[model samples]
Target: MSNTDHLTALKDKIQAVEDGSIVAITMPVNIYLQEAEDMARCARIDIAELATINVTEVQIDDLQARIGACREVQSLWVEDQHKANQAEDLWADIQVQANELKSELIHTFRYAYRKDEHLMSAIADIAEGSTNSDTIQDLNDLSVLGKGNTDALTAINFDLTKLDTAADIAVNGADALAVANGSRQRGSDTKVLRDKAYTYLKESVDDIRAAGKFLFRNEPKKLKGYTSKYWKKRNQSVKKESDVESEI
Candidate 1:
């Protein structure tokens, strides 16, 4: 029911990736936030050099804004995932009952329409697929088919009210599950925007690091502040493991 057009719009404006690969968070988001904070701090080392490339105080403020957006959206994603999970459980329960009803209708329809070529063909089409979505849609199709051919059902003493029940079940279940599915879909959309925000922040951080590294090329102490300690440790840890593997 909730509109996700805004989320889609935000993601498009970011243009994070051309290939559309917004996946699991690459690192803990807290680390990304801290990295942004540290980058912002180091950018102050030589604001003049950064300003030469238009990476001004306004850009720095925007970087913080992007970080804040990522943080807020990340919390909302957690809530959405929980809601989706609950809906999935409800859908599973409803599907079991729906499937049983569909099977009952199939067997009865075969008997009621066995002598009629046209009706049998319609029944055949309805009995085709084997998925939850198929079950939901079949209920709708069956309701229509049943109502249009009540004379056939009446001769067989079929309960016409079941048609109404079938139609209600189909409509209600489909509407509920559609919203749940929309929530599931919004998961990726939310991540796309969240991931794009991180990309935006990292781009600024990289810009600041590049300038800082170049400006402090002659000063090792200031240069340390320009680089990512997280990556430095990770690389060292990885190299240590590789060295042990080579020794083995």
Candidate 2:
């Protein structure tokens, strides 16, 4: 194929892989495997065409040997895929256990103390406006992308660690507030509990924002509203400073 034709064909292949068509139990995994297979077939075809284009026998043999080496790597990838599937299954099971525990705790203790009406209300308010759900979803994304380059993955892991710590602190603070308000009236440690909750809530928000800023810093277009504007301006200023420094 001509260069333009090859480019168009590659684009078509990429689109087909990205189309999200459901041909199996899981669309993404199947699509990725199919894409790999297609690319390997294309490589074989290209090798055959090269052999027919007046290439030396030695060159063809070298190409064939390289293909064999790649096939060996592909076999190693199959082993990696099997291990990844096991890890994913284990993670799913952990999620189920965690969800069960969360449900049981809420059901068994949320309303056990009738005098904890104010405490329960505080918890509800916190839950209603919480960024914990988004934080969790981002963490899942980070985990799934863990196989990327070591430096990039390490940066993501660091941000996730910060987020996890902040989330834990917020959760612990909420639990403490709940315990404090469970027994005492408004005249007791109510203010203390409120202050604790507020401090943790603010910390959670700050940490979450920091994580998001780092996560999408390279793709400011993906950010929304104030975040998009802020990052865009920040990126432009940094670029300008770097350019001036280089000129100096």
Per-candidate alpha-carbon RMSD to the true structure: 5.6, 27.4
RMSD of 2: 27.4
TM-score of each: 0.68, 0.31
Off by over 4 Å in 1: 1-25, 42-56, 76-86, 112-119, 129-133, 143-165, 214-225
Best by TM-score: 1
Task: State the lDDT of candidate 1 residue by residue for 1-248, as single tens digits.
Answer: 11243334344456655436444466688787777777777676567777876668877665556556666666677778887888878887788878888889988999998999998999899999777778889998999999998898999899999988888888877976887798898876766666776665566666777877887789898888787778889999999999999999
Q: Per-residue error at 241 for model 2, in Å?
A: 68
lDDT digits (tens) for residues 76-194 of candidate 2: 34555555555545444544543443343233333442246754564344334323342333333223332232353253343434334334443543444344333333323333322
User: What C-alpha lDDT do the candidate models reach, one value each?
Assistant: 0.76, 0.38
Off by over 4 Å in 2: 1-53, 125-248
